[model samples]
Target: MTVTPRTALTIAGSDSGGGAGVQADLRTFFANGVHGLVALTAVTVQNSLGVQGFSEIPVDVVTAQIKAVAEDMGVDAAKTGMLATAEIIQSVAKTLDEVHIGRTTDTPFVVDPVAASMTGHALLREEALEAIRTELFPRATLITPNLDEVRLLTGVSVTDAASQRTAAEALLEFGSQWVLVKGGHLCDTADCVDLLTDGSAIIELSGPRIDTENTHGGGDTMASAITSSLAKGADVPTAVAEAKRFIERCVMEAYPLGAGVGPVSPFWRLANPR
Candidate 1:
């Protein structure tokens, strides 16, 4: 019998706490049955409580890491998270452009606009946000931005489903092929709703919100799940729906591990196999 190999890449930061960032992304990928690769943009000192310190890897180093993996092993789909600086974002954007222009234009690229951690720790600076919008958004196959990130990206305050639709439209204008505006921060209901828009149509995913403080890396895990599914040949709506369900399950099964906001268990699917 022959084995088929499916590879996915995560270009993100590392969290020492092991709950979010590259760690969470890799775990999600593994749980979804895909081989995971990483390109570390920064190293974060964080636990369930909060981030203490962070240092970004230099641009050249980041580029080299990306090139080393992409040129040899190859990637079916890729996701990005927590680009700490504008320079790093630009570097990644350039490398991705090279890949998209040269080889695979249909390769899925999921971009998680990680502006801040759940504990209110600043992940990306203000200038870096603009750089991401201008440089990387256009290249991404999908951009996942939470409510706060949507506000930061477009200066539009999202409060309800209507506002979320408005925000999604504005984000679509930013040049991404698809925009997933996560409404986990909305204060209206006990249900969490997220909007996925591809400039032409809108898809709403809603589920009962899990009441837990372990929401630290939910966005990263969700986006990674979608990317992994895409790598496995799922369509956009199917991928987003599966990813949303995966995240909700993770939140429900969240364990208290840190002093502050805990981390979602990306392996919840495997741990509680149906």
Candidate 2:
């Protein structure tokens, strides 16, 4: 007898460089033994150097794409990233609400707050942040935000562990059921620490720091990996743990492609299977 494969959906932007955005998400899902699906919100012109520009698809088209997937394939879990505009955010949120996706316990919604590229190029419209907070965040099963994004979203700076907790709490106030604070950008530490909290007990995930600038799609990969794990029946904590382990290996296996920053190896199993 054959078993059905789990399905994971990534509603995100497109990356011409193929290092980040929906491309990375799909790659991550597939690498984790998931059947990947996507609903594109925008198309980006970017590479290892930086993002040149991006153009958002119409709200109607984005909504239609999401509905097509939800009504047909019926995703086991979903991941959200790079919603470029207020209109797009609303469209994605409304579509998810209409389809009854990501609102239940079994099907998780993993959201990555992708506000900008690593080099400080803007990926999300400033106005879209408010839209996400009000409309999209409350429904998320988990929200993953790097330190920069956490500061931007909550206006809370991370000076230490307490400050990180404050920022995570502020995000929880925005209605995210759980918040994962990524500390890869914190240069003050010898090890990178990620904080996961659901307004209760906190789980601190730490890994030995790997010095590499090729972490272009690392955030997207983590969130997509969590979604894949959730679709495969892992709990939120287990899903996050699995994702963190995958990312550490990916960071270790990072390889440069161009003159600028490189991207993590989503398919680390191919090069270094464990």
Candidate 3:
């Protein structure tokens, strides 16, 4: 029998390398049994070596793409990545508000807060930081930030669990319903521990730290998995826990691509036949 899959939208840039950004998010949505939709914000000239150059889409065009999908197909959940500028961030925030598809609305909204490429090339402009914190954070249902992004957003360098909580609390002050402080960069630990909180209760989700350099798309994969779970009707905490499990497996199955880092493989699901 034919089935109608639940829909999730990604408002982000395109990764020409097929590793991260919209490419990774769409692949994740499909892997998790959700229909994927897009509102492309920018296009990057990148590879495993790094991001070389990029161009942002017009703000009006970005706004229109979001309106088109959210109006006609409907978005059960949505996420943002690599907005590229303060202009795009402000416009995307306004568009999300207009469509009623954010924290203030019933639909779940995820803010990945992408600031740089894995190879240390800046993806978000330096000036866009304030706009993202002030405009997008308040409207986010959940904000998933890697340790580096946490430091960039809140100026809190997370070296351990104590500091991780402090950073998550700081992000909560921005009005997001939940904050996930990803601890994959906490190199001191044997396990990759992510802290989830809503300003009161706290949950620690841990996974074995797979020893691999092919982790290029790891962040995008986890965030997209959460978006996919949210689209499939899971609650925030449940969605996040499920995403943690999904990403750990993807990381373990990661394979090398180019001379530099490679992407987390979602194709493992196909091989395992789950």
Candidate 4:
């Protein structure tokens, strides 16, 4: 008899550039030894430089994909990214709720509050931001937000470690079981510091910042890594730490592959011949 690999699901938008969104999530899942499934919320015309246009998939189509995957292949863990509209967010939240009701033990949801691309193109509309805060955040197991997304969600500016902690705490009140406030956009030091808090304690993860322009989908990739780790039975804190370390290594060895901010090689761990 053969043992089948665990499966993970990504409910996100599509990146025509094949660098972020569902593409990045699936890459991370495969790299971490999970079969990847997808429920596309939108289609984006994007390149390494920027996103040019986007069209959201209808609610029915989104719902159909979720039901199809949840009913058959079954997911051990899941992550969401760039649900372009209020309707999409609400739809996904409901679908995840149904999945949770069915398989309470194996369902972990990682929510990446992706608002804009690295090139400054808006991915989620400003109005949809409120929908995520109101409808989706409460259902997520963990929410991963970068500096800009933290500001957008909590109306707080994170300029230092102290501010990051405060932001993480405030974000916890939004309804996620835990919050990871990414400090990559801060210019104060040569290290990237991220704060993971679950209301009581804060876990600070720091690593040497890779001085490279190839960070287009770092946020998406990190969140997916955490989801993959959790699907493989790691605790939340351990998963976050491991994912952070993996991302740091990827960044350190990042190669420029596009004219704009490029993608971190998600399969870097596999390429090591040692």
lDDT of 2 at 94: 78
lDDT of each prediction vs. the true structure?
A: 0.87, 0.88, 0.93, 0.86
**Highest-TM-score candidate:** 3
C-alpha TM-score for every candidate: 0.96, 0.97, 0.98, 0.96
lDDT (tens digit, per residue) of candidate 3 on 1-274? 9988999999999999898999999888888889999999999999889999999999999999999999999999999989999999999999999999898798999999999997999999999999989999999999999999999988999999999999999999988999999999999899999999998879999989999989988899999999999998899999999999999888998888888889998877777867
What residue runs in model 1 are displaced by over 4 Å at the alpha carbon? Answer: 2-4, 101-104
Model 4: CA > 4 A from native: 101-106
Q: What TM-score number comes out for model 2?
A: 0.97
Q: Is candidate 2 or candidate 4 better by TM-score?
A: 2
Where's the lowest-lDDT run of ten residues in candidate 4? Answer: 97-106
- Tens-place lDDT per residue, model 4, 13-35, is 99998888999998888888888
lDDT of 4: 0.86
Q: Please give, for residues 95-164, the per-residue lDDT of candidate 2 as tens digits.
A: 8888877645457898898999998999999888898888878889999999999989899988778898
Candidate 4: residue pairs that collide: none
Residue 26, candidate 3: Cα error in Å is: 0.8
* Model 3 misplacement above 4 A: none
Give the root-mean-square deviation of each candidate in angstroms.
Answer: 1.7, 1.2, 0.8, 1.7
- Global local distance difference test of model 3: 0.93
